[model samples]
Target: MAILIYTQNYDGKFKKSVFELVTYGAAVAKELGTEVTAVTTGKLDTETLKELGKYGAEKIITITNEELNDFSAQAYAYAIEQVAKKINADLIIFGNNPYGRAIAPRLSVKLNAGLAAGVTALPSSVSPFTVKKRVFSGKAFADVVIKSETKIITLNQNSYKVEENPVDISTEEFTAEIPEGAYAVKPIETVKSSGKMSVTDAEILVSGGRGLKGPENWGMIEEMAEILGAGTSCSRPVSDLDWRPHEEHVGQTGKVVAPNLYIAIGISGAIQHLAGVNGSKVMVVINTDPEAPFFEAADYGIIGDAFEVVPKLNEAFKKFKAEN
Candidate 1:
């Protein structure tokens, strides 16, 4: 059994999913008594290649080039194809990030493999590999069995933990001729979040909804988030109204997050909204509506006006900090 992983080098840093994908791929390779190889191409320092070993990759087939700066769906698809062909890979895993979203479908078509996105668990069975993924916007789940000759799975971020310590992996540079084609779409702008902790990386997340009243009142939420060292997220409507960037929008139309603790203020737990945040380990719902659906999923619920409740909570947190 041959295994390969596709990873993106973001400003010389591997995306978080790189660890999960590599760890899973390495396990599959170990079970099959095969080599676990990582395939990545981008503008990255050579030192980053050696970092793959911690995730259990035996070798990294990397393409280091500055021309690979901007994303080219064609270039990425072509490069991964080369690695798949050379490695004779039976399985390929990606982090399921935005870039992976663009490449996985193309790779699946090119490799003639079964594709499953938003996967949470590792493969239950590899031979005729089957995967489990969220469906109906996480209202339910379905297990899919791929009988295809090759297997490709994209792991969702925050779904699996990367091994904290891994053996250092050796990397080998593999070059490929980039396919010649004009990109249909190129990104002219990338607006990143300015939060203290990105939602995915945050252990605590504080979010607000329509109850925020207006963007002018958002200061309370932001101040609390800053004190807690947590990330800030908004309801879908809040972002759609331009109060927040689309990336900070946490819902069916935006990012899905599962942090250690999720504190939603003034947010009514609509089914669509819950779909994105249901994975959180601990949920705290602070809503004026006692009948809000989010309470069912929350570990704690405070039915009160967010304006008053949040200020009191902030004062308590501050006093406790001062005492400690």
Candidate 2:
């Protein structure tokens, strides 16, 4: 049996999360004494598909069905099931993103596989297959075991580090017979964000909260993000006041993130907000109040006014980058 990874590409380019899955899956493949094969839906450039080779995928399978293009969860699940069965994949892997989250559960039920979502670590022991994952919105960790004959896992982003080991890759096209009425719901329209890093995809993020006082003063935060090449986000109160879009909000009630580095300016870290972003590798909190709860969760804390501290930090970052 082989290990199968579901690789996703948007606009012909793969996200960083895909490589994480490949890296994680490749390690599992080595443990199981098998080669890893990747299955993706959509037409991508040969070179772009070959990039998976660096992460240890030996074969790439492309599902070239036009009906599968629109991303109906049911249809995509059926397509992936066929590929997995055809290749006799015992271990199936996905990134814990919107696309993977939507389809992984469905695929699990379809395949009758025990599913472990938001997995954060490699299998501690592969004989019985135990994996570690975040629980309670990043507040705690739990070890999960998959008992089914076929196992499914959706890995959390930034959990696995990519290590390149290049090999010759081969690509094959498969046309799956999607059952009747799989694509029942069709999306009417899709709006794409341009030129800015999405919070979920960003490696670094600079976020603000009510501490900033007003949306008008967000320029300093934006300037800092620009200098650091980071994404911008907000706390729940800031979004509630419409200082920022709800899409930029991070908390228990908002989007969750696990960037490599997260800088919080003017945000008082409530348990809810910390629940969302505590997965970040490094966190820096900037607040004038020395006793703000945010300091408890931050790896580094700065006690100062954001307005005074942000600009200076931005200039320092610029100089550091210029000198390096």
Clashing residue pairs found in predicted model 1: 53-169
The TM-score measured for candidate 2 stands at 0.98
- In model 2, pairs of residues that clash are none
Q: How displaced is residue 24 in candidate 2, in Å? A: 1.1
lDDT of 2 by residue, 1-324 (tens): 689999998877887788888988989888889999999978888989989998889999999998887888899999999999999999899899888898899999999999999999999988798999999888799999899989999999889898887778999999999987987897999887665788888899999999999999999999888888899999999999998988899888998999999999999899999999999999999999999999998999999999899999999999998998
Which ten residues in a row are the worst by lDDT in model 1? 176-185
Note the clash tally of each candidate.
Answer: 1, 0
Candidate models: Cα lDDT each: 0.81, 0.91
